[model samples]
Target: MCEANAYVRQDGVEELFLEGVDKVVPMDNQLYLENIFGQKKMIAGTIKELSLVDHKIIIEKI
Candidate 1:
């Protein structure tokens, strides 16, 4: 229930990247994201914002 949805922002638009993200790890130049369902993704971006109250995470591509 504490998991959050991740989004990628581009050109002022936000797109859903992943849902139910439970873990986030920064490795080198990429960000690693994992969901509660065992889903995983590695993205070349930086964190833009994290809204814990809204359960949202925003990432900006490099």
Candidate 2:
């Protein structure tokens, strides 16, 4: 239940990228996202916000 939904801010809009993201690791210049279901993704972006109450992880593309 600690996992949060990940979103990417594009053109001032927040778009859902991943659900149940449980871990985030920074490697090189990309961010690695691991979900509770063992799914993973790597993205080149900067963290914009962490809305714990809303369970949202917002990131902005660089």
Say which candidate scores most in lDDT: 1
Assess candidate 2 and give its TM-score to the true structure: 0.93
Candidate 2 on 17-36: residue-level lDDT in tens?
99999999978778999999
Q: Model 1, range 1-62, lDDT digits (tens) per residue?
A: 89999999999999999999999999887899999999999999999999999999999999
lDDT of each: 0.97, 0.93
Pairs in clash, predicted candidate 1: none
In terms of lDDT, model 1 sits at 0.97
Regions more than 4 Å wrong, model 1? none
What number of backbone clashes does candidate 1 have, counting pairs of residues 3 or more apart or in separate chains?
A: 0
lDDT of 1 at 9: 100
lDDT of 1 at 2: 95
TM-score of each: 0.97, 0.93
Give the distance in Å from residue 21's predicted Cα in candidate 1 to where it truly belongs: 0.2
Give model 2's clash tally: 0
